[model samples]
Target: MNIYFVRHGSTEGNETDQFQLPTIELSERGLKQAEVLANRFKSIPIDIIFSSPMMRASQTAQAISLVTGHAVNENPIFEEVNRPTAVRGRCKSEPEVKEIMKIVKSTFTDPDNRHSDEEDYFQIRDRAQKMLEFLSKKEERNILVVTHGEILKMVLALVIFGDKITPELFYEVKRTFVPDNTGITTIQYDLSFELHESGWYVLGWNDHAHFGEF
Candidate 1:
C-alpha cells in the first residue's frame, strides 16, 4: 500500500493562532497551497482520496479531487484531536497555550485522562491507529488522506515507530515532525517483505519540493 499523508492548508484560526475550531475551511493561501499540492500529485498513481469530516480538510480534499478526478471521502474517524468546546474559537494566552500543550502531552502518556469536553489522549491515539487499520484493510495501492496536524503526527509516529511509541518518541515527533500547508509525506508497505520481515518504508518526510518553501 502507498499512502500520501497531507496536512490541510491554513485557516482563519491558524492565521490568528487560535485553538482549533475543527470546522473552519481553508484560507485563501490554503486554497492556493492545495492547488499546488493537487498539481504535485496530478500524475501520481492514486486510487482513492480520504478526508476528515472537518471543512478544512474537505475543501483541501476537493482541491486534490479536482486534479485526480476522484471524489473526497469524509470519515469522522479522521477528525482532528478535539479540544474543549469552550476553547474551540478562543485565543489562547501563553498560560492557556501551555495548558493545551499539557493536555497534548497528557495524550502521549495517559490515554485515559480525557478532559471534560476533549477526547482522551488514548482515544486520539486509538483513533489514529484505526486510520492505519482502515488503510491496511483497503486494497488500493495508492491513497491520499487529507487531515489535521495533530492526528497526522500521531498516526505518522504510530506508523514510523509501530506500537513502541513512548513519551520521548512522541515528544520527538512533536518537536521535529513539521507538516506545513499541503506538505506531503509518502510511505509504502512492501508485500515482498514479510509483514514481520520488511515493513513500511517512508519515501518522503514533509516534502514540499513541488511548491518550494512554504
Candidate 2:
C-alpha cells in the first residue's frame, strides 16, 4: 500500500507559533500551497482521502478532492494533540514560549503524566494504528491523508517503525523532513504487516516542486 501523508497548509496560528488554534484558518500562502499540491497530484490515482476535522486540514483535502474527484472523509483521530490548560495561554516572551514548548514536548513523550488535560499519547497511537490497519486491509494502492504536523508525525512513527516514539526521535524525523505547508510525504508499505520488514521508504518530503520554489 502507498500512503501519502500531507500536512495541512500554513495557518495564522503557525505564523504566531500557537499550538491549539482551532479557530485559525489557512493563510493566503496556504491556499496557494494547497493549489500547488493539488496540481501536482491531479493525475495521480488516489483511492481514499482522509482528513482531520479541522478547517485547515479539511480545506487542504477539499483542494485535493477537486483534483482527484474524491470526497474527503473526516477522521477525528487525525486531529492535532490537545494542549494542557496550563499552557493554553499565548506566550509573549521567548522564555515563556520555550516553557510552553517544554511542557508540550513532555506531554507528547509521557502519556500517563501528560498535561493536566490532554489526550494520552497512547490513545493517539492506538487510534492512528487502527486507521492504518483498516487501510492496509483495503485493496486500494493509493491513500491520501491530510492532517496536522503532529498527527502526521505520530502516524508516520507508528506505521513506519511500529514502536513508541520518543521526543528525540520525533525531533530527528522532523529535522530530516521539514514538511512545509501543504507538503506531501509518500511512504511505500510492503505487503508484509510487520513494520520492521515492511519496505517503508520516503518517496518525497516537503516537496514543493509544483510551486516552482516559491
Q: Which candidate is the best by lDDT?
A: 1
| Full-model lDDT for every candidate | 0.81, 0.73
Give the per-residue lDDT of model 1 (tens digit) for 71-183: 99999988888877757887776577668757755654555664456765567778888888888788898999998887888887887788787657866897898788788
Pairs of colliding residues, candidate 2: none
> Candidate 2 — worst ten consecutive residues by lDDT sum?
85-94
**Best candidate (score: TM-score):** 1
- C-alpha TM-score for every candidate: 0.88, 0.82
Native RMSD of candidate 1 (Å): 2.4
lDDT of 2 by residue, 57-116 (tens): 999999999998989988887777666665543643458656766775666757676546
